[model samples]
Target: MSNYCIDIFEFGRHKTQEVTIGDVKMGASNPIVVQSMTTTNTNETEETVAQIKTIIDAGGQMVRMTTQGQREAKNLEHIKAQLVKEGYNQPLVADIHYNPNAANIAALHIEKVRINPGNFVDGAKKFENIDYTNESYLEELEQVKKKLIPLLNICKQNKTAIRIGTNHGSLSDRIMSRYGDTPQGMVEACMEFLRICKDEKFFNIVLSIKASNARIMVHTVRLLVQKMNEEDMYFPLHLGVTEAGEGEDGRIRSAVGIGTLLMDGIGDTIRVSLTENPEKEIPVANQIIDYINTKEGHDAIKKVDTDNYSPFKYTRHQTNAVKNIGGNNVPVVIGNNHFTKDSDYSYIADSSVIVSADKKEYPVVKYSNSNEFDFNNHELCFVKIAYSDMDDSAIQFFKQQNNVVILLTSNNSNSTIEQRAAFLHLRNHHVTTPVVIHKLYDSVFDANTQIQASCDIGPLFIDGFGDGIFIENNTENQSLVINTMFAVLQASRVRFSRPDYISCPGCGRTLFGLQDTTVLVKEKTAHLKGLKIAVMGCIVNGPGEMADADYGYVGSGPGKVTLYHQREVVKKNINQEDAIGELVALIKENGDWVEPS
Candidate 1:
C-alpha cells in the first residue's frame, strides 16, 4: 500500500495557514506552489522587487534572486524590505552559485539558500570534464563538505532550507571522473550533501537531481526514490527537467517525465521549468499535481484538494497509444499484476513477472505456489484481474501463444463502451495480432469489471474507421489454454529500432555552423527511414560517436566541413554552404537515402 497518509510536516520548512513569505507557505502542502528565479541584477532593488511582486501575484509561492557577488549580498536587506513593504510574503530563495559567503549573507532574509556543491568544492572552476584516473573523488567530496559546512551553518542559523541540486553539464570533475557523467553519478553527488545534512542533524534539506534529457530526469528520480525508499530517506523531491527548451516540446517533456513519476507516487513537490515567463511555472505545476492526484483510483488525494479541479481528460485513443510497440498490428500486454516486472522471470521469453508487493514469502517458488497459478515454465506470466482466475500453467500457456494480444484494461466504473472501442482501435492500429482482454481493478474500485474478447480480423484498418468502432463485450471468449496456443502459433516479428538524429553538443573548438548545421540536417532528414546520421562538433569524438552512422557531417573549422561514409573520411574541406547537400550525397552513396520530404 502507498504511504499516502503522509504527515506533511516532515518536508523542508513548516508552514501553517500561510507562513511569513508573501502568501506562500513552505510546508502548507498547497496544491500548487510556484517558484522561479530572476534573471535581473540582484542589487537593482526597484527592478528586482517589481519582478518579485509580479511573480508573487502570478501565484509564485517562492522567488529566487541571484546573489552572485558580495555587493549583491549587501543588497539583500533592501530587497527584503521592499518585498515586505510590497506585502509580498512568498518565500525568497537565494541562488548562490560560487560564493559561500553570499549564502551566509542572503540567508538573513531569504527562506532558503541553494548552493552548487561542484562550484564550492575545490575553490576553483575547472572545465568540469573529469579526470577519471585521479581516483580522488572521495577526497574532493571531503573538501566539498568542508566548504559547504559554513554556508549550511549560516542557513541553519537563519532557518533556511538548502537545495542540493546537481547539473549534468557543469558537474564536479571528481564526480564526473568517478561516475562517468551518468545519472547515478549525479545521485551519488546529491547523496554526499544528504550525508552532511545527516551529520549536522539538519532535516531541512530538499534534494534535486536533474539532467538535460527528459528520459534521464525520469530515470534519475526512479534511482533516487529507489535508493531512498530502500533506506527510507523521506526528503522532499523537487522536480525539474533541466535545460528543457521553451514551448510545446518543453511542456510535453516536462509533463510526461514528471507526470509518469508522480503517477508512481514519487514527487513531493515540483517545478515546471522553461525559458518562458517565470509565472508560467504555477499553472503547469497545478495542472500536473491536479492531473496526478485526481487521476483514476487517485480520488483519495483528489478529495483533499480544496479547488476540486477535474483530472486530465486524455482521449481513450491517447491513453491506448501509451503501449504501442514497433507500430505493430497487435498490441502486447503484460499481466497488470506482478508478472509485468522484468525482475521476476528467470528466463524471460515473451512474458514478464511482477514481484509481489507483500514479501512475507521466503522464495520466488513459494510465492508463485501460494498464488492461483502453476509456475511450470516460470517464463509464462499471470496478471490479476477483477474476475479472471486461472492456474499458473494456464497463464503460462496463454503467454506462450504469440497471436494473443494483451490489452491492459481498467476497472473504472466510468470506463465507457466507447472508450473500450477506442482502445481496441488503438491496439489494432499499433500491433498486428489478436488482442486478449484482461481487466485489472484498483483495490478501491468495485471488483465487478468484465472483459469482452472480440475478434475483428482483417487487413490493417485505417485510423478514422477504427476510431469510429464501438467496443462491447462479446459473450463468446477463447479459453486461456487456447489463447496461449494461438500466441505460440504466431511468431514475434516486431523489431525495435533506434530513432534518427544524433547531434553532438558543441564544445569550445567547434567551428562552422555547428548548431544550425545539425538542425538543418535533422530537418532535411526528418522523414528519412532508418537513416542514422551524425552531426558532430569536432573530430575528437566525431569519428568515435559517429561510428554507427551511415553518413557523418563533421565541422572541422569555419567555412569548412568534413564528410564521412561508413566512418572512413571520404572528403575534407567541403564548403559549409554545400555541406548539407554533400552529406545527402554521401548518404545516397551509402545506399541509405530516402527521397527528401
Candidate 2:
C-alpha cells in the first residue's frame, strides 16, 4: 500500500490499479486521459454521434452521454452502433443518475457506466431530513446494496467499468444527518458503494468526489486518497470541479482545483465541465494535463514549516494584515503597467497599482529594483528582487523597511521555480514581509496566457504562500488580463468581486434551453456582487449541486422552473417565461438586491 501524503513539494504518484475502458486505459504508467460529455439529448442518435465525433477530433479520448430514463438508456445501443459504423472506436460512458434500471441497460451496451452514488437508488427531489440511529444507517446501506447488486452483476457480465461518482451538492439524507454536508460525508458516500462493489467481487471501479467549490473539491479528493490507502483500495480517481461557469472563469476554476491535485500526483483522467460546447472543453483539459506533465519532479520551492500543516485539509497561514492584504483579509490582486500621461485609470478600479519607480501617480504600491527610490508617498512598496541578485545588502534592506512587500521576478529559465525559491529564502532568513507573486509572459494567445499564469500562481495560493497576484501579459486585451486575475482569485476562494454562477454543463436531462437561460440569469443578476447564484439544468443536479448557492434557478419540467432560497423551495414550478422576473423579486424580498450603477 502507498504511504505518501498529498503534498506537492514531496512529489510521488500514488500507484493505482489500472482499469481499461474500451480501447483507452488509465492509471499506472499511462498518460493522463482527457474526457468530455455531450450536451445533446441522448434520443437524438445522429446529433449525439456528431458531437462525439467533434469531441474526439478535438482531442477527447473518451465521451460521455446522459441516461436518465429507459429510453435514453436503450438509445445508447444505437449511439454505439453509429459510432462504430463511422470508423470511430472511442469509448462511450453512460452518465446515470437516480435510475438503477437505466444503469443496468447502459452497462450492457457502453464500455463504462458512471453512476452518482448519492442518487443511484434514492430519487432526486426527495431530500427529506431524517434522523437515523447507527443501526438504522447500517440498514440504509443494506437496502442500497440490494438495489446496487443487480447493476454490479450486469457490469461484471458485460466487462463494463463503473465510476462511483459522488457530487458534493447531492449527498443523501442519511449522509447529511450524520456528517452534515462536509468532505468526510462525501468520502463516506463513495466508500459505501465501493464496499458493495468489492463484496460482489467486482474490481473494475473508478471513483470521483466532485464539488463546485475548489476548496471542498481539493480537500475531499485528498481525504479519499488517505481513506483508500488505509483500506488498501487503489481505485483511480477522476478529477473535476462541477458547474464551473463558462469562459475564462471556468478555465481558471478547473485549473486551480485539477491542477493543484495533479501537482500532488493525484488524478488519473480528467474532464473540465464548462457551460459552453463540449468541444471547447477539450483544449483546456489538455492544457492542464500537458503543463502538469512537464513539472513532475522539478523542485519548485524549498520546504518550510509543513509539519504543522495538514496536506489533507486546508488551513491558511497566519500573517499580519498590511493594509488590505494578509491575516483575515482576502488575497489582493495587483496590476502591473507603465502609466502614461494619457492612460485611463478609471477602467481598472478593483486592482491595486504596481507602477514603475519613475511614475509619479502615487499608486498603492511601487515596483523597483534600486534601493534609493522614494517610498514616502505609497503605503506599500514592492521592491523587485531577482533570485540571482540576492545578497546580504538586499536581505538587510528588506528587513529594515516595515512597509516593503517583495515583488519576486525571475531571470532564470524556470521562472516559477526561481520565484518560489526566493520566497523560501526569505522564510529561512526570518524575513516576515508579505510577498506578491508577479509573472510576466510573452504569449499572444489568450489560452496560453491563462494556462501559464494559472500553473505558476495557482499552486502558490493553494499552498498558503502568496499574499496577492500580479500578472503581466503582452496581449493587447487588457480586460482579459484583469478578468483572469479575478478568475484566479475566485477559483482560489480568496476573493469575490462579482456574482458567482453555479451553472451545470448541459446534458440530455436538462429541461428548457440551458445555455440561453444561463445567459438571461447572468444578464439580470450578474450585478449582485458576492452573491452565489445557481442556474441548474435539472432537479437531479439542482438542490444538491447548488450546495452553497444563496439563490437557485432549477428546471422542474418542460417550461417550468423552481426557485430556491438556500435549499428551501420558495417557488415551485413557475413558468419558465416569468422565472427570471420572480427570481429578481425574491432577491429584493431579501436584502440582497442592489441597483447596477
Candidate 3:
C-alpha cells in the first residue's frame, strides 16, 4: 500500500491488498502468481477447456480465456463444468472487450473477469475525435456507470474479482482526446472504472496498464501505482507486455518490461504474452518469477544516491563517453570474439570487438584475466574480473586506471547479481570509467540464449548500469548474435537500430488476419530504422496502444484497416488488401520511407 517504489537494493516485495479469485490468493504476502491465456476460440468449449487444462498442468496458477460476445460468454459455463469434471480447479479468468453483457455472463461461471475500460462500453469502431467540455465528460461518465452496473452487480453476487485492465493500444476516444495517449491517459482510464467500482462498494479488484513497448509499460505501471496511492486505493496489479512476438524477441521484450517492474516490487501476478502455445508462456513466466524471487545480493550491493534518478521515469545516467562506449552516443554493442590465431575478425566490423590479451589486438579491447595487464592502452584495454577477483586490489586497480573499461564477469549461478554488485562497487567507489557488461555462456547462443542473456543483462541496463553489452558464446551465426544484442538494446530503449513493430498477438477480438498483416507491414517498413509501426489486431487499443509509434496500421473491421501518422488517424476503413500499400505510400508522403537495400 506504500506509495514509494521498491528499492532495487532492498529485495522487498511490496505488500498489496489481497484479492482472492477462487482458492488462489494474490497480492499481500502471497508468492507472486503466474497466469496465461488460451488462444483457442472461446465458443469452442472443448478446445478451450483442453488448452486451459494444458496451461494449468504446465504450471499456470490461473488460466484466462477470451470472452468477446454473448456466445463466448455463455460457453464459459461449459468450460468451467468440463474443467471441474477433469479435476482441474485452477481459477479461470474471462477476458472481456467491447461487451459488458459478456462480462455479466462470465462472472457467473468464472473466478474473475477482466474488462478493458477502453471498449467495455465505448465501441472500438467509433474513433471520432470528440471535443468534450467538463460537463460533457461528466455526462459521458454517467453513461458508463449505467452500462457497468449490471456487470458490477453480477460480479458482486458471484463473489468474482475484476481486473480493470487498460491496454496501451486501446484507449477510448474520450481518453485520447483528453489525455493524448500517454501514461497519464492510461492511469486515468483505469481510475474512471475504479471510481465506479468504489461507488458500488465492490473492492475485490486488480489493476493493469499494459503496453507492447516496455518503456511505456514500466512508466504507466509506476504512474498507476502512484495514482492509486494518492487515491488511497490498494488494488493488486496484473502485469504483462502484450503481443510480445514469438521466440527470443518475445521473451526478452516480456522480461525487460515485466522484470523491470518486478524488480521494483510492483506486480502481484504476471503473464508473459508470447505468440506461441499458451503452455509455452508458463515456463518463461516461471523462470522470470523464480529468478526475481531468488535473486540475491540486492542487500549486498552498496546503495548509491538515487536523488538523480526517478523510479517512475527513465533518464539515462550521464557518464563521460569513453570512445564509442558512452556519453551522448547510443549505447554500443560489443561482440565477443575468442582470441585465436585463425579467429575471423570480419564479424567484428562496425562493432567494438572484445578479445583476450594474448590476441594482441590494437583496435579491439584487450581482455586480460588478471589485473596485472598493461593499462597503457587505457582507451582500448578492458580487464576481465571475476566476482572472486573483486577485492580492494581489483577495485583500486580499476579506480587507478580511470580510462580502461571494466569487463565484469562471473561464473556463479547467480551471475547477474554478482555482475551487478561489481557495478555498484564501481559507482560507490566513484570509479567513473565506462563499463561493458560481459556474460559468458559455455554453450552456443541458440533459441534459449536470448532469454538467459536478457534475464542476466537486461535488468542491469534497466537500472542504468552498462555502457556496452558483450555477449560471449560459441554461436557461429554472427548475424544472429549481433541482431540479438541490438534487440536487447532496443528492448531496453538504450539503443535503437531497427524498426520496432508494436504488433499485437492475435486474439478473438482481432478483426483482421493479424499474423499476415503484421508480416506484410514488416516487409514494407522494417527498413525504416528506429521507426515504430504498430500493427494492432483491432481498433480497441489500436490508436492508444500504438503509444509513441511513428505510424500505425490497426484493424478497424472485417477486412478493413485504419492507418495513423503518429497517433492521428490519417486513413480510415481502407480495404485490408491495399492497406499495406497505402501505409507505404503514406510513409513515402511523409518522407520516412527508405528503399530497402
Best by lDDT: 2
Q: Report residue 366 deviation for candidate 3 (angstroms).
A: 11
> lDDT: which is higher, 2 or 3?
2
What TM-score fits each model?
A: 0.55, 0.89, 0.83
Give the per-residue lDDT of model 1 (tens digit) for 1-597.
223222111112212122233344333455435566664668788988887787778776777777766778778789888888877766777776667777778777778777765564543334346665544656666677777788767766777777777655445667666776576777777788878877877767766776444445556666765566555566666776653434333454456556545544556567766545566666766666654454433111111111211111111222222123212223332222223221111112223333232322211222224344444444322322211122345345433544222332334332222223423333333433233233323222110111111111100111111211112222123123222212211111111122234454342335665556766776777667556567765554455445346777877777789988866889898889998988878777777776753
Best by TM-score: 2
lDDT of 2 by residue, 1-597 (tens): 224354434555667889988888888778888999998999999999999999999999999999988899999999999999999999999999888999999999989999987888766636677889889989989989988999989988899999999999888888888888889999999999998888888989889999998878888898898888888898999999999888777888899889878876888999999988989999999999888777755544444443344555666555556565566777766554533332222112245455432443333433343545667656765566676666777777777777776767764444555565566666667677777677777768387668767766776676566777777765567667767777787787777878888898888878788888888999998889889999998887789877679999999898899999998899999999999999999999999999997
Report clash pairs, candidate 3.
Answer: 168-545, 169-541, 169-545, 170-541
Which window of 10 residues has the lowest lDDT sum in candidate 1?
A: 451-460
Q: Residue 383 CA error for candidate 1 (Å)?
A: 16
Query: For residues 409-439, what per-residue lDDT tens digits would candidate 3 score against the true structure?
Result: 7776656656656666666566676777777
Residue 273 displacement in candidate 1 (angstroms): 1.1
Q: Which scores higher on TM-score, 1 or 2?
A: 2
Better of 2 and 3 by TM-score: 2
- The alpha-carbon lDDT assigned to residue 199 of candidate 1 equals 85
